[model samples]
Target: MRKVGVLVSGRGSNLQAIMDRIADGYLPLEIAVVISDKSDAYALERAQKAGIKAAAIERKACASKDDFEAKINAALTDAGCELVVLAGFMRILSANFVNKWHHKIINIHPALLPSFPGLHGQGQAVAYGVKFSGCTVHFVDEGTDSGPIILQKVVPVMDDDTEDTLADRILVQEHIAMPEALKLWAEDKLVINGRKVKVLA
Candidate 1:
């Protein structure tokens, strides 16, 4: 089985989803470690509860962004992680760090990407008055949410939808989509061609 390292910065709902899938024997992989940039992030607590090795590498301790990511890379490497999943990780990674991982890193965004790229993606979609908004799982590229799209699930935007409501719905889809994407990757079924991902049957 492939080993996964999860990076998180906040509540880690997606991280929880992956853990649930693993526990239920739905995902064919092991969570080797969970790393967070914030010392006080709830994700760390979640990792501990799941009995996964967890660490907090505060970005403030590093002299530069590269240094921080280097430490993160070392931590993941030490854990024997083959895949890195970014579940609400807030930092913008440097080019060197991104290149080192290349297609090995995956991230889930709250909105159908190429639409709302950065933070508050659900709010951005709601404000823009989109009828359909959802979540996307993609390979992490140098640009913000600009990597090859792996999977996407569209959720209808209700008339009374607030940012929180929309995000909640998208989060459900993320829970499903993220694990599916990871499964595909773990099985060596995902092929990246330029900006697209081809899933081999």
Candidate 2:
């Protein structure tokens, strides 16, 4: 089984999804560690409850972004993590860090990317009045949410939907799509050709 490292900054609902999948034997991956930028992030508690290694390397405490990333990298390396998953991690990684990991890192976004790339994706969609909105799981690159798409699950935008309501709906799909994308990666079924991700059957 491949070992994965998860990075989180908030409540970690997505992290919980991955763990649930692992426990149910739906995903053939080991969660080697969970690291959070916030010491008080509940994700750490969830990891501890699962008997998984958990750490918090507060970015504010580090002298520089590089230092913060170095600590994170060391933690991942120590735990023998082969892949990195960003589960609601709020930091914008440096280009150097993204390059170091390259295609080894993946992230789940609340919006069908190449659309609402930054924060408040659901809000962006609602404000833009789009008929369809959804979630996306893709490789992490230097650019914001511009990586090759791996998997996407679409949810329709309702006329009376607010950001919170739309986000809640998309969140359900996010929980499903993130694990599916990771499963593909673990099974060696993901092929990255330039800007595209081809899934092999």
Candidate 3:
């Protein structure tokens, strides 16, 4: 089975969904380890419960950004991780770390992307009065969320939707898009061309 490393900083609902997919034999890969910058993150707890290796590499403990990245890179590399998945991983990786993985890393963005690329994506969509909003799963590049697209799932923005409600709805799609994209990766169905990703037959 293909081995992968997962990074998380929050509750890790996405991580749980991905792992569930794997256990159900829907995702053709294995989670080698789950690393988190926050020791208290529930994602780490989830990983531990599943009998997977869980690591806590706090950001403040490191002397410098490079040092922090080196530790993280070493962890994944030593674990023989072939792919890295960012499941609500809060830290912004340095270009060196990003380039190390390059196309091997994938991230889930909470918006359609190329719009509201950073945090508070749901709030941005609500404030912007968009009638529709969604999530994007794309390859992690040096740029923020401007990487080549993998797959997207759209959710309509209800008129009375608040940030929390909109986020809840988008999260459902996130859970769907993430594992589906991983399935494509496992099948070697993703062909990156320029700024686009083509799904193979």
- Report the C-alpha displacement of residue 114, candidate 2, in angstroms: 0.7
lDDT of 3 by residue, 1-201 (tens): 999999999899999999999999999999999999999999999999999999999989999989989999999999999999999999888889989997999999999988889989999999999998999999999999889999889999999999999999999999999999999999899999889899999
**TM-score (C-alpha, index-matched) for candidate 1:** 0.97
Q: Which candidate would rank higher by lDDT, 2 or 3?
A: 2
Q: 119-190 in candidate 1: lDDT tens per residue?
A: 999999999999999999999999999999999999999989999999999888998999899889888999
TM-score of 2: 0.99
Question: In candidate 2, how many Å is residue 146 off?
Answer: 0.4
C-alpha lDDT (0 to 100) for residue 20 of candidate 2: 99
The TM-score, computed over Cα atoms with residue i paired to residue i, of candidate 3 is 0.99
CA lDDT of every candidate: 0.93, 0.95, 0.95
Instruction: Rank all candidate structures by their lDDT, best first, as comma-separated numbers.
Output: 2, 3, 1
Residue 1 in candidate 2 has what lDDT? 85
Candidate 2 local accuracy as lDDT? 0.95
Report the Cα lDDT for residue 63, model 1: 97
| TM-score of every candidate | 0.97, 0.99, 0.99
Root mean square deviation (Cα) for candidate 3: 0.6
